[model samples]
Target: MYRWEQRGNLWCLNPSRPLGIVEMIGGGYLAARPQISYRFLLEELAAAGLVIRAWSYVPSLDHQGQAIAAWHSFQHEAKRSGPLNYQISRRPIRLGHSLGCKLHLLAPDYGRDCSALLAVSFNNFSINRSIPMWNILTARLGLRTEFNPSPLETLRLIKEKYVNPHNLVVRFNNDKFDQSYRLLETLQNRPNDRSQILVQQGSHLTPTSLGINDYGHNSWASDYLQRQQIGNFTKKLINWWEQNAC
Candidate 1:
């Protein structure tokens, strides 16, 4: 059974285990879709012996409120679970994907007490503006749009306040190679050189697609897990986090 609850404007998923970290899901419209995505990611993490608490928020409204909710969940879990015996001490890490990364980056004031941040597929200002013309046209027609907040403002805030000496931002480069490269360039210009950048083979959307369980098919989870690229990427991400965030 899932330990689900609505905390203020955020939907919280607290797995029935001592929380080791908190992951905030990025929803483009409503909480349900991202919650489903996060559930898959959490299952993968749980298989690797990491307990995750997740938050899903409504996209159009409650941006600030959702950020605060994520912060509170981390704080509450840290207080409850105490320190970890892992590499980077027992502090809880904040993991964000896509637009979720932007939200976390912009809300530095909220998660000031978090141990570190894992930003998956983060894009910088110019790179965000440089989205594919096709994508822009589709979005204009309300066809293909992801749940991204004010990406430029978010990056500016992160550069100004969040990316600093103590906390680290590890950006995973997947499909959006251009955005990832631009993000690295922007980080290089920042004062904090402690941030890390990694370019992986997959794209920004691949991770979510890889983790999906097609219930309509028989034994879908097992079949999905058997794919070569999925298995390799999953293992690599898990190992990388264990080595770095632990």
Candidate 2:
């Protein structure tokens, strides 16, 4: 069974099992917004027999302070409501999308307890200087680019602390976000015990772009919805937990 509860500004989804995962959504503007990814994740995880709890906090352009506070709150609430098996502590894992990934990568270190991280459609990359004025204007007006923080700082922090040299998985879409190659280069330097970089065909909003219909070779929409893929990912994450935890 699945239950949804409201906790202040956060939405908590409790599954029958104690073990659960948290996913943060991304809103381009400073105002908090909802994305289709959260719903898709919930349905997919539920089908896979895994408990999934999610929260969407107020979005902020102030990437320094409020963002950090929101993440801290997310961590606290997730821990309090999620499965408390002593075994799962050393196996902490996070899945974040877009700006959420950027914020998570900057999260303060919690010692060796923090184990694994998976980033999807992450948008932490330097701005291309060669873009035309019209394109820049359109990006600023259409996508609300001004609200986005410097990807350089986020990338630096991820390189220094976020990407655990022990376990990390990076999933990207080649069609969207041309800077993925550069992002991969930064992640490859880290000494992850097991690191995987998968390039699926799609765009930045692949989770919502392809929908749930066609499971094509150049698409991740199907993979995202696959129970077996979820199981496999969970198993890989659990293996990391077993090896790292005492």
TM-score winner among the candidates? 2
Q: Using Cα atoms with residue i matched to residue i, what is each candidate's TM-score against the true structure? A: 0.64, 0.65
Ten residues in a row with the worst lDDT in model 2? 27-36
Candidate 1: clashing pairs of residues: 28-147, 84-90, 86-246, 87-246, 88-246, 174-202, 174-203, 175-202, 175-203, 175-204
Instruction: Give per-residue CA lDDT, model 1, range 1-246, as digits (tens).
Output: 455555443445544444355555553442345545555555565555555656556544334455666666655654554444242344556666755665665563644555566666654333224445756787678874432335565555555666533333334333443355554555566774545665565455544543433232336555455344445654666555556553
Superposed by TM-score, candidate 1 places the C-alpha of residue 52 at a distance from the truth, in angstroms, of 1.1
Poorest stretch of ten by lDDT in candidate 1? 209-218
What lDDT tens digits, residue by residue, belong to model 2 across residues 44-79? Answer: 554444444444566554555555675676667756
> In model 1, how large is the Cα lDDT of residue 16?
42
lDDT of each: 0.52, 0.51
Error of 2 at 130 (Å): 15
